[model samples]
Structures are given as C-alpha cells and as structure tokens.
Target: MWGVFSNFIACEIGFWIVIILGLFTRYVLKKNKLGLFFLALTPVIDLILLIITGVDLYRGATATTAHAIAAVYIGVSIVFGKSMIKWADERFRYYVTKEGPKPIKLYGIEYSKHYLKRWGKHVFSYLIGAGILAGVILLINDSSRTEALLRVLQIWTLALGIDLVISVSYFNWPRKKDD
Candidate 1:
C-alpha cells in the first residue's frame, strides 16, 4: 500500500516540479520558449506516470482508489496545466509588479464581456478535458472506473458553475459599470 501511494506521490511531486520549473524559467528567468517548452512537456510526464501505473496493473497488482484519483489528476492537469499556469503568472505579475489583475479585452469587449468569453473558453476546455479523462478512465479495468469518471465530470461541472456565477455577478454589478 505504501509503495503504491509513494509512487503516486512521487508522480504528483514531479508534476508540480515540472510546472513550477517551467513557470520560473519562463517568467522569472525570461526564457519564454524554454519555459513554455517545459510546460508543454507536462503531458509527457503524465503519460509516463500512466504507463507506470498500467505496468503495475499488468503485473497482477491490484489497483487502488489512489491510482484512480491519480489518473484523473494527471488527465486534468495535462489538459489545463499550461493555461492555468499562464493565467496565474499573469495575475501574479500584475498584482506584484503593477496594480491588480490585468484587464483583458477582445474585439472591443471590456471587463465583463472579456471575462465571459474567457470563462466560456474555460468551460469548453474543461468539457474536452473531462471527455479525455473519461475515455482514459474507461480504459482502466478498476472497480471504480465509473465513479472516477463521474467524479471528473462532477468536479468540472461545479467549476464551470462557479465560474459562471462569478462572471455574471461581476457583469451585473452596478458599481463597475462603464469602467
């Protein structure tokens, strides 16, 4: 049990280490392509981890709940990792180096419209992500495959709902009108 858990933990650590290293290299060290290159390779690490898990299962080892969660985690992270890291870097840089969150505009759309569009993209991205993870989960022969896939869908749905609420609330707020 500890062995399986430790391996998954190591994978998680490796996952974050790659992201952080890429982020630091790209943003902090000013190596934009290098950073993006590192971030872009995150899915490779995920694939490797998945392969490791699959090999273990092939060797007659029992799959645990931890393995299922790890699959979902890797799937979601691979799909959203680069964009999430980019978004965080922007906000972090803006807050620390400039004012608050940077305002984004597309095709003359201002704050709320911009955020709505962004959130819409996020929703679509997460849906695609969920589909990818679901397909992968379906391939696994664990007893919890259905539950794990359902959990992925549930989490993304909840996230989209929260984002919708925040975007709409911010758009409808009177104080920030015409800004």
Candidate 2:
C-alpha cells in the first residue's frame, strides 16, 4: 500500500515536471519537435502508474485506498490531461514568454459554465474509476481484500454529490468580477 502511494506521488510529480519541461522547451528553447516529444510523455506516465498498480494487485496485495486513488488519478488524467496541458501552455506563453494574449479570468455566467463543464468531467472520471475498481473487485472476488476500495467508492460518491451542489449553486449565484 505504501509503495503504491509512493509511486502515485512520484507519478504526479513526474507528470508536472514533464509538462513544465515541455512548455519550456517549446517556448524558451524554441524546439517544437523536442517540446512535443516531451509533452507526449505525459501519457506514458499514466501508463506507468496503471501498470504499477495492476502489478501490485496481481501480486496478491490487498486493494487499498491508495490503489483506489491510483485508479481515479489515471481516469482523471486521461479525461483532463489535454485541457490541463492547454491551460498551462496558455499561461506559460503569456507569463513566461509574453507571446500570447493574457488568459481570460472567468466570472459571472462564464465562471458557472466553466465550473459545470469541469464537474461534468468529474462525473466521467468517477465513472471510469469506479468501473475499474469494480472490475478489480470482481476479478479478485474477495470482499475482504477489496473492502478499502469499496469504501473509496462510497466516499467518492459523497464528494461528487457535494461537488454537484456547488456547481449548480454557481449558476444561481454567479461570481462577481473583481473590482
């Protein structure tokens, strides 16, 4: 379990390092091909995490919260990774290189709409994570081994519910732009 958690942290740190390096290479060094090569490594990081987690489970390790989180992380990364890179690219171009327009600051209805879109992505991520977790539980076919993963699903479901409420509330009370 601890090994899985450690690997999860390492994967997250590695993902960002690759992203920043990619952006830097693209904008600062002006090497488009190398930058793209770096950016393309993001999926490889996800694959590494998935393989590590799967291997641990296959070795007869009990499914843990860390294992469950690894699944969720992979799902979220797959769904949001492109947008995340784009968002970072825009900011890196604007702030680091002063090459692009300033990133827009969302507020009011736009903010609500953006929040809703992200929440929808969260829904999709949850479905994918839960499906993987369920498949694992069934494959293992041992309630005792998968109890922690089940708890993770229950907790994540509650978190998703809370997120939905907040997302909808943004529409009712749109945020005001800063003075």
Candidate 3:
C-alpha cells in the first residue's frame, strides 16, 4: 500500500519535472524537438503507475485506497494530461520566452463554459476510474479484499455529484472580469 502511495507521489513529481524541463527546453533553449520528446514522456509516467498498481494487485495484496487512487490518477491524467501540457506551454511561451500572447483569462459566459467543460472532463475521469475499480473488484472476487476499492468508488461518486452542482452554479452566476 505504502509502496503504491510512494510511487504515486513520485510519478506526480516526475510528471511536473518533465513538464518543466520540456517547457524550458522548448521556450528557453529553443530546442523544440528535444522538448517535444520530454513532453511525450508524460504518458510513460502514467504507464509506470498503472503497471506498478497492476503488479501489486497481481501479487495478492489486498486492494487499498492508494491502489484505488492510483487508478483515478491514471484516468485523470489520461483525460487532462494533454490540456495541462498545452496550458503550461501557453504560459511558458508568454511568460518565459515572450513568444506568444498572454493566455486569455476567461470570464462571464466564457468562464462558465470553461468550468462546465472541465467538470465534464472530471465526470469522464470518474467514470473511467470507477470502471477500473469495478473491474478490479470483480477480478479479485473477494469482498473482504476489495472492500477498500468499493469505498473509494462510493466516495468518488459523491464528490463528483458535488462538483456537478458547483459547476452548474457557475453558469447561473458567471465570474466577473477583473477591472
């Protein structure tokens, strides 16, 4: 369990490290090809996490919260990773290299729409993660061993519901633009 948690943390840290390095190489050093190579490594990081979690489960370890979260993390990464990289790229280009326009700060209807789109992504991520959790539970076929994963699924479902409410509320009350 701890191993999963530790590796999850390491994977997260590594993801950011690779992103920063990619941005720096791309914008600061103007090494576009090398930077793209670094950026492309993000999926490999997700694969590593998935493999570790799968291996742990195969070793007869009881499913844990960490294992469940690793699934969620991978799912979220798959859904959001490209956008995150693009987000970083925009900021890096504008702030570091002065090679692009300032990233737009969405407000009003735009902000609400952006929020809703993000919420939709969250919904997709939850579904993917829940599916993985469910698959694991069925594969193990042991209630006692898979109880933690079921709990995670229940809690994540609740969280996603709450997020939906908040996301909808944004459309009702759009954000004000800065003066």
Worst 10 residues of 3 by lDDT: 170-179
Off by over 4 Å in 1: 95-179
Model 2 C-alpha lDDT per residue in residues 92-116, reported as the tens digit of each score: 9999999999999999999999999
Q: Please report the TM-score between candidate 1 and the true structure.
A: 0.57
Q: Which ranges in model 3 have alpha carbons more than 4 Å from their true place?
A: none
Per-residue lDDT of 52 in model 2: 97
RMSD of candidate 1 to the true fold? 5.3
The clash tally of candidate 2 reads 0
Model 3 per-residue lDDT tens digits across residues 1-179:
79999999999999999999999998888899999999999999999999999999999999999999999998899999999999999998898889999999999889999999999999999888889999999999999999999999999999999998988998899899878
Compute the lDDT for candidate 3. 0.93
> Can you write out model 1's per-residue Cα lDDT over 6-69, one digit (the tens) per residue?
7778877877787777767866787989987877777777777677766765675655555555
Rank ordering of all candidates by TM-score, starting from the highest: 2, 3, 1
Comparing candidate 2 with candidate 3, which one achieves the higher lDDT? Answer: 2
Candidate closer to the true structure by TM-score (higher is better), 1 or 2: 2
